[model samples]
Target: MTAAQFRTVQQPLDPTAAVGEIALFDAGGNPLDLSGGGQKITSVKATALAAGTAPTATLANGVLTIGIPAGAKGAPGTAGVGVKSISLTKDTDGNITGGTVTKTDNSTTAITVTTA
Candidate 1:
């Protein structure tokens, strides 16, 4: 096509109320993405954990609070190599009564705990 067959003009587009949809196009007449803040949004995925009692979930003022399971109480990790013996004394009912934990380090720190 010759130059005369093409025309370039700038026209203001101000649609009034009750008008139809508004479509945006690029230089090549291809439909441009103007969905999410004038940018392209491919997918959106949100996951929410299941609800519970002791460990409940709360959301307030765009903030989320999730409760995690509490750690084991009155228990130490595996005794290190320098530990001589990690003894735990219990009664006949299997209830933990008391214990004496000893570690064979240079300082030899000994700890004793009694619940009964």
Candidate 2:
């Protein structure tokens, strides 16, 4: 049976309260019989597989084991620099020629601008 066939059970007002019983139903709203030789999940295990591998699941000895592939690690990122202030360089006609970007750590970088 698929997980979609079972309905979710809502908890009582007190989450710590003991549950008397759980009812299982199908997608068609039909109740399932839990009478003869009903099996209970005894254990669950998860394994990490190599990157690019597909996820898999298997049931054995009332235990469920799943294998999940790990995603590839991305390249290292460049350090971020915060801007603190900027100083503009002006030409003879008071037109902006370029500027200097001052970082939070007191470091400065020059920037060029093309006036339109």
Candidate 3:
């Protein structure tokens, strides 16, 4: 020990501001079961979900309304097994412009629509 008393001691270049306590591990290293009741692990600030200016659906007589596409409204068949015979030949006409839907075991499914 003689290179002029071997002087070399300098370590504190912003060492994470000298962290006080943060030892929590569990991926087989055990010791991280936070007690199951007083949950504590907090530090989260990065948010962006508040840009508002575009939501118009007004109708006060100027009439701007759109919504009338229907299907899946078949319930109440128990008095004598009623809907066992209700076929729309397919065009339930919610508007694709063509129709065919016959299924109660007679099996006949073909409803095509292709438009670009």
The most accurate candidate by lDDT is 2
lDDT rank, highest first?
A: 2, 1, 3
Q: Per model, state how many residue pairs clash.
A: 0, 0, 6
Candidate 1 segments whose C-alpha is farther than 4 A from its true place: 1-82, 106-116
Candidate 3 local distance difference test against the native: 0.36
- Total residue pair clashes for candidate 1: 0
Model 2 CA deviation exceeding 4 Å by range: 1-39, 81-116
Q: What is the lDDT, from 0 to 100, of the residue 3 in candidate 2?
A: 31
lDDT of 3 at 16: 65
Tens-digit lDDT string for candidate 2 (1-116) = 22312333665555577543435454566765545665455765778989998565554565556677899989999888899999999999998999999998889999899746
Relative to the true structure, candidate 1 reaches a TM of 0.21
* Candidate 3's TM-score: 0.14
Write the residue-wise lDDT of candidate 3 on 50-104 in tens digits: 2342222212232322222334456787543222343333346554644466556
Expressed as tens digits, the lDDT of each residue in 6-55 for candidate 1 is 12245554566533343434445565444555343233222343434233
lDDT of each: 0.44, 0.67, 0.36
Measured on C-alpha atoms, candidate 2 has an lDDT of 0.67
